[model samples]
Target chain A: MAMLDVTPQANGTAPQAARKPRSHARMAWTAFMAILRRDIVVTARDFIPFLLQVLVQPLFFLFIFGKVLPNLANSGTSSGFGNTFTVLLLPGIVALTSFTTALQGVTLPLVLDLGFAREIDDRLQSPLPVSLVAVEKVVFAAMRGIIGGTVIFPLAYLILGNSFQVRTDAIPQLIGTLVLVAMAGATVGLTIGTLVKPEQISLLFALILTPLLFTGCTYYNWSGLSSIKWFQIVTLFNPLTYGSEGLRKFMMPPITVTTPAGPQSFTIPTLDAQWIFLGLGVAIVAFFLIGLQTFRRRVVS
Target chain B: MAQLTDNAIEVIDLVKHYPKAPVNAVDGVSFTARRGEIFGLLGPNGAGKTTTIGVLTTSVVPTSGKALIMGHDVTADPIGTKQLIAIVPQQSNLDRSLRARDILTFHAAYHGVPRRERNARADALLAEMGLADRAKEKLTRYSGGMGQRLMIARALMHSPAVLFLDEPTNNLDPQSRLFLWERIQQMNREGLTILLTTHDMLEADQLCQRIAIMDHGKVLALDTPDELKKIIPGGTSLELRVALPQPALVSATGTAREESGLLTALRALPGADKVDEIAADPNDPAQEGITRYRLYGQDAGTLTAPALQAVSANGGELRDLHLARPSLEDVFIYLTGRNLR
Candidate 1:
């Protein structure tokens, strides 16, 4: 028979004689989920900022380009043929909305907190690997990206009216496009967050984000750059172009065309849809790797 | 890798030097903490105590040395080593955005505490640390004491083999400091190894089983409280208060002197044990003329009746009598000619 040793208890409750060992596997799951849950909950703390970031900008773009720009173009034309403007602007609006939402949701806060406020130190100390913490941030950004993109959809649909085809068959492709686009955007945001110091963050806004907005294939398609060969060559360096072009292929496949009349047509031509999607995927993975490595280095060293 | 021992902590010449600083922050500091012991690392500000704790907790890597917790090298296997240790930073790093209870639960989950067990542990720690009432409140609403308590509870989430506290009560009020000490003592009683750093001599005296005083990035002294006090040659030099602080015709009994007041220093008299009661100043020192003797004794009670009579005969008023014993401060002065605090 095994003998049991007795230890005195501070409380009145007698020792239970048997204590259970902890399950580390279960704890890992709890840790990951807890981070995700906490991040989600705290995002609600700044409700107005969240709304402005996720809904306001997308709405502004949709109303301006989706509704106003096309209307303005139609009024100038006696025939009132501005319906194609809606088709062209809707996909770009979706891509732009997701990009902005993802960038703000993950990048700015991550860089500031990890660099100056040091709010992320608590999470880093958790039993979870540091990479999981970074992943949680990206995951939260992805969720917000989906929300921002979806918010613009109904408004764009109302503006596009019957001319905007739902293309139910393209739903799967659209969802796939959104996921890839969000990943690419968020990963790029993470890369930016890692590269910029706390003081240099505003410089990133002026220099990096501005360029991203212009060249991210939001207002125009890759094929549209044919008129300016140099501009097309420069845009090849912008990862956002691949994401926006891939999204256009998914949301408005019929719009993927080129008149070849203007030196730079305002439509996507010569750019292969499959290649754009692959490039976006590749850029997303590469940025994630670099960002994660940078994050790990910052946390450890 | 080394075999695990009953000692939860073993540090061998742990050294850490920052690139920006000219000297090493922690230099060749080595110590061991047995299981269930409250070991203390004491030093003045910038004395390398926090840096040493950082190395042990795997937060900052050591420059050239190694620290092992439960047989895991802190540098080579930080994840495995961190699994057995938790650190309470000098500054509060609790997520201000998180509710107090969620803070506890989140820390638990991060340490791989099981989901079902996490809530129970969180509740128990909160209640034990007197934080249960405020557990639902956000951290931004917590006071200094409450934040420190929450940090302590956070460290307990994993039930780590060794808990490292870096100045756990630095800015806390006295009452909160006492409360935290009691909880830490309770934790130690349950067979958990605790390593703490502080410059408060009184705290170290009360809680540490063994202490190491560090200064200028080096260990000045390391010993049990009683043994450390022995470093002072003639125990404590008492300063007795009489109506007249200035003694007339100061005389030396044994190896002691009447420095000030009715205070007389006796080198090695009898009946000067630690439990001996110390008398107060005379009621009317100016009128009745109070006389006090400053008794200086070695090994606690080196002054006694003979020395007292001699002081009384030597124009000293016997208004109040008092005996002082060597404190950790005296040991600090003996080692570095300065107080530990």
Candidate 2:
């Protein structure tokens, strides 16, 4: 033989075998990464269309509502409310786009795999736990969310000109919030994917994702909705509301307004940083548990 | 010759009933395959063969009863059981997202196949399946037969101790069916235990070393094909429907066709076993308004001529006649199921 060949042998051990936990862990990790590799290859194959999908909606929203409409409101003038409006709009738009990417990335394929194609059967048949299979999906979707969130920053700077107010000091906070928000969004997708029936998948996206974007405080800030008291409270229940607010908490400059007592920078307003983290934390835990349960139900039975 | 080891699959008193369903899908079905045996579950539609295979492959949970794959309980240690078995489903469940090459590679990865050896094993299996030339093509480009071949190759990627083929030849052409049959036999010869489900009588008889004939969610008979044939009153089955000149339903003597001694006439002949009258399907336009009877015989080739003469001698007109070989269907009908309506 020209080269040495390693045989294709499987470690046919019992799952309940307590003697070899180390080998079992390695096998589980190997299977998990294999599924991840497959997902990456498949996603990368459609990279262009996916990239365009994530960018197009937010790009247009930033352009039309933040750029064109503000300029028109300011009577076609250059320097006015456009700057403030873009700064306020940028965080929400980015949150909306990235979260929506995570949600759809997990939900659409999950519905198809469970409902029509039955491709998930292969993973269920793999030498790993079914719950781990579901977790891998959320993990991959969250990764996309992080990427989608990061890719928007340069675009925001380009469109908003000098109006972009990303505080350089808050880089760590921004990275942390970005990852957490992505995880929250991906978990929500996992929940929706498992809950929705394949036949009603079209209705599922329209009923869930659309309402999420509209009511998620994506188009407006939660603090700005003072007049609508009930609506503000309701938006607090929405996870994406926290995502937008969290990004704003980290990225935007901390409460600065001109007051009678010199320049005031003391009070952080009603949308507290602590509450945003709490809401996202709850979403990640609650949705993942629910999604994992339903996913096991659908696959095993 | 391959060494026959301990049981590769052991399913006992298995029962699976969907919620609110009138009957159990798999009712008290029990069987075991010794290592390296080419075992089969042969049945008509709704026989619960698929469900039985489903439980074994970890895709379905049993309502009750125990199933062990190589002494590992499927429900308790499913991951352990999964490491031992792989199923080629009845439906096209291959990853449509990947090419043939990626599908094989991904499946190898899923089973924890070594990274370095993944491509080599996949390449060898593809070449064995005669699909190496088209490994880069999209799955949609492959024909039904080629897709099935790829699935079989993928199932073997892990070199599972037991492989499941759920109606592997269901929609395949004759040439492809023969090709797959040969492949299945080759795999079995290499010391890989195989379990397959099918409704085709000829398939079960030809391929399976030991067959379990199932119907109505139960295994009606299980044995080697020859032994199963020997257990029947006669090995060959002769089924024929006769249309009388008058109203056949005039008397419900269970059937008007049985009022004559045509049943006795056929049973009296040499090479003939007891004759049973099966109610003709009311929905079948060709066989409607007539009474059908099945005559089990030692040799259908010898009994066919005399049996046709006997039908005519009893003043009955033979509308249609079918001589089924000593296959799974003969064992199926002999063990008592609804007529092949």
Candidate 3:
């Protein structure tokens, strides 16, 4: 064994074989990162103006819901009547902000580039499979989503000032919720981005997205819609509802209701958090796969 | 891993049929392109030029037959085929949001260029295409010619084995066209195989080492420009411009007779050979209002210079005279009986 293995040439060949596969994997990772970098750079270049617009919108919403609505509702005192408006709307703002940021990640520019500009053609022709490009889009959207969420959360807090009560211990849960919410929006964005022609993008926002946003559970909790069973069931079809509900559960006070099951609940109990995370994870993964496939076909065809 | 070889492109009877069409869009077109040749697929509109290129580039599937790049069948090994080729479509498809150089770098990285090499390659390609000055400008700011140049640079960034240019300068101005053609020629000469398609026959004549002219999904002719020109009905085409009218007047210097200013061909002459025509100009060449005639001879040299000297010496002004060899257009008309347009 010693004589056979002693040769430098034999030892070199053995390592080379092992090294090839590992290096190949590394090379693939590098390609993936290049795609990610390209997206982020483009996103960042436009990030300044986009962030200005994004920050303004959330700030406006914060002013409206956090300051104006509470003041108008509680006679400028906002302290009385439970001052829960801030906490109630915090999660909604989070979802809305993330959703808006995620929407751009896959909207007019993406659609125009796919259908008209054909910029995606370059990416599709890459040695990496088309699915990787699609995934990178989601990753870019997720990064922007997290950034939007992080930016809006503290601002929402600073503006609300004691009106909102976000449980400190549930920070991990909030992070998980934001991640999933961003993913859901990004996937829907990718799917819709591929579906709509560039000329029809305005109609997409006017018709589909506007209606979804209006009916989404952005203003109220799933538990609050007790009387409207059918409406609640219908809302379940929307990923936004789940996003908002999961987010609210992590932010607002735990609302308990007495039902036939006695003390039925919507909150993800500490011990059962994994189930919520799992559900969110599954939804993200499923939408991602569907979006990935749709994007690939759209690019190829 | 599939390996790239000397023949950059090999298509064998490639056919592509759309869903509702009664016939294939591309019907049984075949050709082999060497590794570093500038090959042109010349054809009229709807001649399956785009369809054939789309199939070869993997943008569309062939209904039947096979196209291989670097020895890998496009249908069987799409990713490998794609990795070795880049297609610059007839349309401008630049990423408007990105800076000019980013297009090249992004494309290079997409083809698996490492991060360390991407920037340098992108810069080199842009510089090679004379686009370094505008590298930081977004595509939205670039003009059509700059955009087209950038597209070429992007395609070459990965140093693809073959580059497919589908009408690379279709809508460009004359200056831009000449610029791009020179760059394209340089690229081919630098050892990159180029497969270009264009309806402009002159471009094909000037640039292509070999060209295939197609029409209605059929290969009308395939050869060098000179060879294709020889296929025209007449061995040589002679366009003689006479300032007069439809045809030039012809009379023998010594023995011909003219009645009412009409010169008679007067058959086999002693001093000259068979002169075919004397009529008004088919295409009026000048404002002289003078009538002209055309001549056809098995040997034009037998009578051309002598006839011109004789006409000038005989007090008739030889206002306009031109002789040209047949062009690819002549061959195209001879073969297809129509203009490519």
Candidate 4:
């Protein structure tokens, strides 16, 4: 065979004296940013579909529970229960949209990336630790969740006018809750995304997602679940319940209901603001670690 | 470490056995490629070529033993190994949503190329791969060959020290394959060490400076193409096609059977070493009544005259005759007892 007579120098050249090897932290950060940028660009190019996916469920919930049900109830007794239900349901919609969107954003892409497409192979070749690729996916998905939640917020007021109320005094806490809830959404997405096979995706939605949404305090506040003691305990295992309750506590005003004995007032269960924030923080770390470990195992092997 | 400075890749006793697999996919394989040479792993499917590349490229950790790329142990310092090498995988794994140019640019950025240099390098690579026209088009819009060229461009975005091309020309049309071959040769000329895996014997013969022929998870033979060809029984072969249905037995006194008569005459030639009947094409109906014979010898010219004389004496008409030098395919068959393809 013909041989090339290019530079016959071996090892190409000596490592440049002026160029120091990058610290591990720097390399990891660069890889993270590059992957994040690529994913964002891809997502932006498909923005219309992404926006539709994020908005569809929240809009559907707002139109049905926030607008239709309340109108249907008002036509009967002018009970004001319709208005109160709308206020309570608004926060749940935001939380549910954020969590489910985040989960789908991570899981579906991951399934495709790891299975037929193998697009993640490109990112796996990066100089960063293999686990960091999983973390990057989680981080980006969380950002999408936050974006989805932000977009859904205004539509609630537009569709359920004069029904939804924002507790201005709790605005600071609300913003914090939103951020924590978004992170939790992403963390759960990462964990489930890494655990699932492409073939099991349909089962994921059927078995896992459907249950999480219904029992996740999306329809009723956790405080109201006290009547069904077993359900209250079981729903506590769902991370979305914390986010939903947290959003309700910060986003809505107290609702008064008349009992047979007398008129009484109750608010959506707080589950305590401290515990909600703490649970979200812990879940974020725990799920992230698990996802990272699983991702590294899958990619390396 | 010292060997690593001179060699772009080194594998020592590398083995990889998937969980529950009955046998190792890459079993105890070892080879080394110099910094400027194009080394090939030529083998049939399931011959462990891709698995070996996977181990050297740090994608699959070995079950035992070690592999190093540019002096960094792959298992101990995979990031360092990855930094020194890039792989053009057998399949098109490029992001379908991204445009051709963005794929290169993003890959460069991931490898730590400066932003300004990333765009410039990506453009240069796109132009080099003949993909400048499609730079702005999404990969989903690219034809198979175009997607392949784009993948080659992406793999070179970072200008890695060593490039691993796994079946790079598998599904290309003739023109695309030739284009890629010329491009690969040009890259090697510019001093990039390449490790290629292909089941194409002709491809290995034309492009590789040295090749390791593997089969059934083991290296059957490793040498330059000419040297490998020399490993077969004889350096040349004379093939004769004759009319069939002649007598099977041969007598020494000219009343011999046609088949034995021809064999005796050819074996009595000056340079004839071995003689055998060539199998007819099973799918060709015309092949049923025709007899083909191959005479392996040191020189085809020396055996030609006697081979022709034998056919004439036996009253068998010689329809066609061809002489060929031993090729890599022949050598592969000799070593593995099966055709390479």
- The global C-alpha lDDT for each of the candidates, from Candidate 1 onward, is 0.71, 0.81, 0.70, 0.81
Question: TM-score (0 to 1) of chain B, per candidate?
Answer: 0.76, 0.86, 0.77, 0.84
**In candidate 4, which residue pairs get closer than 3 Å at backbone N, Cα or C atoms, i.e. clash?**
B249-B257, B250-B257, B251-B256
lDDT of 3 at A63: 84
Better model by lDDT, 3 or 4? 4
Q: In candidate 4, which residue ranges exceed 4 Å CA deviation? A: A1-20, A256-265, B1-4, B238-295, B299-322
Task: Compute each candidate's TM-score over C-alphas.
Answer: 0.78, 0.89, 0.79, 0.87
Local accuracy of candidate 1 as per-residue lDDT tens digits, B1-341: 35447777888988888889899998888888887789988888899988887777666778888788877777786666666777788777788778899888877666655677778777776777677788899877788888888887787776677788888888989888877787777778776778999888888999999998888888888889898887766676553434333434453442133433223333334544222113333453454434333444453343445655555554454555555677776566556654454
Model 4 complex DockQ against the native: 0.30
Q: How many residue pairs clash in each candidate?
A: 18, 0, 17, 3
Q: Cα miss at A52, model 2 (Å)?
A: 0.8
Separate DockQ for every predicted complex? 0.19, 0.37, 0.19, 0.30
Best by TM-score: 2
Candidate 2 vs 3: which has more lDDT: 2
The order of the candidates by TM-score, greatest first, is 2, 4, 3, 1
Give the best candidate by DockQ: 2
Q: What is the lDDT of candidate 3?
A: 0.70
**TM-score of A-chain in each prediction?**
0.83, 0.86, 0.80, 0.89
CAPRI classification of candidate 3: incorrect
